[model samples]
Target: MTATSISPKSSPDRLSLSELEAYIRTIDTSEYTKTRNYIGGSTQLSEYISRGMISLPRIRELVLEKNSFSASFKFLNELAWREYWQLTWTAIGDDIFDYIRPIKDTVRPAMPEAVINAHTGIVALDAGIRQLQTTGFIDNHMRMWLAGLVCQVAKCDWKVGAAWMHSYLIDGDYASNHLSWQWVAGSYTGKPYLPQQDNINTYTESLQKDTYLDQGYGEIASMEIPEILLETVDVLPAHEATLPEDTVTLDGLNELKNADTILLYSPWTLDPLWRKQDKAIRVLLIDPDVFSNGRFSQQVIDSIVWFAGQVADLKIICEPVKNLEVLTAAIIRKSYPGITTWPGIVDEPEMLFPEVPVAFYPSFSSYWKQIKKYSMTDQQSLF
Candidate 1:
């Protein structure tokens, strides 16, 4: 995909905190159905972050409105998931990827037709998938619904569904998408939550009543919509890569004016237009699908072709799973001599930190605050 044509200005409108609050204010207070649907179901704030209009702190504040104990916890928990992925990367270094592959292999030997065609016969899930495909937002409840289908019904791996969902959703976070799918698949911390047909029917009216008539759902009758439980844990900041010993200084970049370097990205944060600043290089190495490419390779192919011109050096690096070594191997095989993957701080600087599971980290918030503070000043390092 050529970076020249994919202008951020041309993309869809992203919802802001004020807009979200205003939207909430307009809803009928007595209509609990719409309240749950709109507040719990919405994913538009992620779209704002994807569009670069809001910061993560802003997102955290807007989402963590403690209207009740549960609402506050759930909103913050989602943000913690994002933090956890970053922390996991820092703690395990490249080994985080090992945790990802087996899960992928177990669930997805082949991409399932029921998922691809939206024919799981579960209407809420089908509508969720269709909505995700079309509008790029699915309710929190529907995410579980669709993910459950991918695991239990479609018999596809959670990674496959997670990968595809990451590509399509504007605000898809690596930790939440992958881990939540695992949670549904009975691989994450808790028991596998397979929503029964009656539970689906109660929350969603779009499904045909007789579709799951024979499928057993006795436990689903007692099932409740799950919410997040929050806890505080220490965390390293996201994208905390090490500054290379021989890294070019700001003065050095201005002085050289002649280094012929190709741009490569170690994607930490999700940005739609990641390769725009590299006026010097025609070739860019990136995960064409933005998150990972297990499920929708064709869409990523089209997106890459649409944004980056012809792909010269294709390297596959799915975080918490694939590493720079694997990606470097691919780049070398492609004969792209100068292409390099961005090394994480865990690999480069060599620090010891906690192996804490996902949690809200208010205590360690200021410790690594300056990591990306100099991003604008040191923009030339990656390219």
Candidate 2:
């Protein structure tokens, strides 16, 4: 395939670390993840930071001296989440494998062929799946749909779905992918997150075909998505906000904007792009690369890369699991420096970003109880 065929239709402007580091300093904490996803990746920014495109200590100092507590602490919270998961892995040691298996193997399979063929008649999903197979990205909302289908409708094992998703998603990571799959399958937090067929139809608005409706894909009932049990909202303490000494907010948004303004993930989310600050540049973020031999269609991967690249100029797009705490801290510190990064804010920081409110649902308490009991008693172990 031509290079264009495998990439997003548009090209994103390359970013530098100084640009992103600057962007991180000024952005609202609640918008961190969303904005990061929009900006895309920071490999380039990482390179600059490593090469002294900007000084870390300088940025840290600037945050402190200005008493820009919100920005400083928010950025720190983002960093902290990343650290937490990393530590969780170390603490659990071999237990992670044990915990993951039950979560992966518990579900039952209901619609194997429909899932495989992308014939479910839900347009956005079919498109998303095709994109997954072709390129590897299915936006956050679409990801929930696919995961829900694997858990509730297909009733397949979470491992199978995760494996399928991982094989293609460019952004896939073990912690986020596995935990997310488990959460949907009732293994993580313990409640299954099954979307009603109608929900899919409504959300995607692509099921005009009567075949799916007649086959009962449309009338299915909804399963409640579970809630997470957090210890305290303060995942990180304010004392940890270590801003480099020289970090400075840019005078204006430009390619010359400070090194901290780099985009970490998707760029489309930046209102300026939508407003046509750089229409051609923004258009380039759409991946022209369209096909691949993988299970996901090329479109998905390209879109993800495109979005990530475009936004990378402003943030750091990392494996959600890798930098979760840092991202979380960044948001918390950015939103409320005085709140004390506790469980309340850490878990539901969504409240800070009104655009992305906390999406509440049922908990997996019952499921975990049953599964744990079965695992200890009658359940057959599988390799």
Candidate 3:
């Protein structure tokens, strides 16, 4: 199986706050509700949200300033979905990688060769995979369709497919990517999410027929794994090993040795104004071990470095937190599991639904029920 062509132009570049605000203002909330299911329909803001380049509260505030909350509920709901995934991850911790519930059936150990090569012969699915690899972007509908194809139709393990997608997604949030795959795989939900050809045709505006998924939902539900999907492919994209040369010198860190506090930033917390008011040393920690396990692409790494460049006096350290010589009292935005650093101050990130407690809700509907009462409240006013 041959890999699809990678497009360098598709990589997400650094955007200034003004640029981000400009994009936010252009978002038409009315169009979002009517066309969100279509492949081309989306706010295209996930990349900004996933990298913590923008926060959920900021987006909600900006969206509400231009559109009424009632009119923009669909767009706000999508953002809340992102928050729900994160809250679920924080509740479950490392267990997010594991199946949330017992798997009803077993599947292949790895991703299907056809999916990796983007030659699944199913027109829309192949195009979505190609877009994901080449551009690191895909609409929410296509994401579900592709995940369902892998976990349900191809019968591959969700982790295998989820990891492959995460490696390429520009907005790859572990909480969102991993949990949504579990949802589609029937680990987080009752039934596997299967996408039929007609549904694909309706959303993608394609007319191709007689593919493996061309059958009715009942027929496709019980069919054996197709021959095309049976062949396993364990290939992951290769990333370059280049590190940023223009970085803050370690010499400057010596000045902060006696300082009372230091502000730490992770790849997920690249906010330039994180602690602008505080008088503290700023450090952006890039633990090599995290990347070794997460397997982010070179483009992702470069984009992160670009983000770090935006923050004033931010020193980018590649080693583990334990390797640092002086462990000053540090303040850090809470990150995902595997970050075991003992920071003196852990700042709670702004959540779309902060009123909802960080407890396990068996399903998203149940979780939403708890937050629905406050959904119409002005989010910025709550801060």
Best by TM-score: 3
Candidate 2 lDDT over 37-84, as tens digits, reads 321312222222221223333444434454444544544433333223
| Structural RMSD, model 3 | 5.6
Per-candidate clashes come to 16, 128, 0
Cα error, residue 49 of model 3, in Å, equals 1.1
Evaluated with lDDT, which candidate comes out highest?
A: 3
- How much lDDT does each candidate structure score? 0.42, 0.39, 0.76
Q: What's each prediction's TM-score?
A: 0.52, 0.41, 0.88
lDDT of 1 by residue, 1-383 (tens): 21221222221242233454555444332333344553244444554443333344554444334344243444444444455545544444443322332333234433445555555556666777777766556776778877776565445556566666765664454545666776676655435556566666666654457554225755332333221101111221122122111233454333223434433433222222334454433223344333332433233333332222222232222223233333222121111111113432211111112223323222233322322342333422101
> Quick one: ranking by TM-score, best first?
3, 1, 2
| Prediction RMSDs, each to the true structure | 13.7, 18.7, 5.6
